[model samples]
Target: MKHQSTGESLSTYSPLLLFICFLISLPISAQDEPKISVGGALRFNYNLSSWKEGQKNRGGDFGYDMFRVNFNARFKGVYLNAEYRLYSDAFGGGVLKQGWMGYKFSDIDEIQIGLTQVPFGIQQYNSHNWFFNLTYYVGLEDDHDMGLKYIHAGEKFEYHLAFFKGAEELNFGSETESSTSRYSYDVVGRNKEINQFNGKFVYKFGDKAANRLGVSAQYGSLYNLDTKENGDHYGLAAHYEFSQDRWNVKAQALTASHNPKNAAGENRDVLKFGAYGAPYQVAADFNLYSLAVSRNIPVNLGPVSNLEFYNDFGYMQKQKSQFTDSYMNVTGVLVTAGQVYTYIDYAAGYNHSWLGGNFKDDFAAGNPDAKWEARFNINIGYYF
Candidate 1:
């Protein structure tokens, strides 16, 4: 599941970069000044996971996590939002998290085009801890791609429709860029994901529209560089969120199938998914389930305003016969201060790429595991 590496790689950011430049070069009347906002964060991480033998034997390890830059501009009803991040080389290095120029037709209607978040599962996130559920690893959660999105927020409901040409590509078609350096997971190697369509609908009820029930559907075509034949993917998800006073509950059930026209002798049931500077295998078809609940506990500790305690669970059932299912659970608390936030999590999983098993093969044709692996992690960041 490895793509050939090329000595030279090209970037596809020229168009977007040019667009930003155009906005910056636009003449602004003396009477009207543009509103620009700039901010970002610095973060650090410490982890002690049982799966890392050396770390477990030596207590744990701590290191720098990331530094990010945020840029936003507003002129009348038009605006731009962009965030770029720098992580250790061991991670994904420097990458753009999201960059989109948008127009707000009204308070509840808008359109965005660029590398934008795909509307699926939940609105912001389904997990409160640092380590998200299994869905995140499979690219079903918090996934962003190069696309155009339209959002409409009506009084009784809200919906999102998007069409993505492909994943954020760092290398143009001129070269064989093999590095899986990115912020979101997508098909890599000899296969390319293209022509994606997404639609999400949500109905709200209760005071302030605090309760929501939603469903999402997606269809996309996969182009195989080797086979030169077209393949496709389809997905569906049902999600619910309930909020009351200081309590919140979120749940989702999703199923997806991917068929790639790989080269002869290659496994069609497994495809390579890459992100965060690494690549892993995922079963071609699977059903996923996730549930999470949280409670806000007001705290008066010095420099700490409040605390949120929550637990999240994810289960992935492989459709291929005899393939074992994957499971994950996270119990953690989020601490929020004025401009700093921390995530303290105790996470465990079986056949999970990040939680325990082999990084490359755990999600595809996984072997019978001895036991569940656990990890204790703390991630704190300062925001401006």
Candidate 2:
């Protein structure tokens, strides 16, 4: 995973300090009117992997998966939610995953302020596959930013609107470096102007066999500090979700266009993708599609009381005809017994697609000359 690093020391510690202050100032009531809770989850993974001809690293590896701690509190009509995540160098590092406070205007409406998930394509999980999908790789899905969020829900309709400062912790100094490419698509290595906006609307039907259709869009401006130039990013998406009993399905398609300012000496026509530090120059427009289906089995085996099988397919195409398109396929099984859960995944990449592409840079494995590659992963997790 590549990420854009914030060049200043303040950007690195301000959020953490703010969270600590908020926790310290939290007032506990003696009347027992307020509610508070603490909880967290820990995950571990043991994996055996192989790489393509030009890729680096191979063989079996084992270590910590991730650790996240959360805090929640409610008093009167106000609520506070926060979470902190810790990961090693191999995974990432300590960071604030989400921190937000909201005031309930009514049972069906509320306004929230602070860092939160950018409500766009999918609320949480966007794909059934272990590697997720291409949208995740480019930061179109499951992306988070500092913003003001508003949400309203009714019997048959729901709406989410937000204005964001920019992608969080985006580093502008070394925008093209690979180390800072993980997470959001801060490929331009610039913080966005305050004009970034995200909007989503969904409609529900069919009570028995639940069905939902939604439309989402985002628009933002990126200003690079290095060249003193600005860029533009905008996207539109449509999605459908259906569920009945133990069967569920989800599908989404999106088109995004970017106009990144040419690096000081680069061509203006080429735009960057991926992350700021380690980016790929490509055409200005691209399309992405994802589909997933899963079924739960009632049979219990040993400690595994719940079992599910899922398959996911994803495709990506660039507007430039000569640019090689990419696709991915993932099939996995999940088993859970109480707090302990395990997953077995088989993932394959075609053309320039890189398996595990969402978590790390796979430029080496994504050679145009390479036909395909595959990986098998076993992940175990426990929640409390």
Best by TM-score: 1
Q: List the residue pairs that clash in candidate 1.
A: none
Q: Which stretches of candidate 1 lie over 4 Å from their true place?
A: 1-31, 174-179
Model 2, clash count?
A: 16
TM-score of each: 0.91, 0.81
RMSD of each: 4.7, 6.3
Candidate 2's C-alpha lDDT?
0.69
**Model 1 lDDT per residue over 117-161, tens place:** 998888678777788778899988888898788899998899999
Q: Cα lDDT for residue 178, model 2?
A: 25
lDDT of 2 by residue, 138-199 (tens): 67767767767789987799899988765555443445322343445544433233347899
Q: Which residue ranges in model 2 land beyond 4 Å of their true spot?
A: 1-33, 52-59, 170-185, 188-194, 267-283, 351-366
lDDT of each: 0.86, 0.69
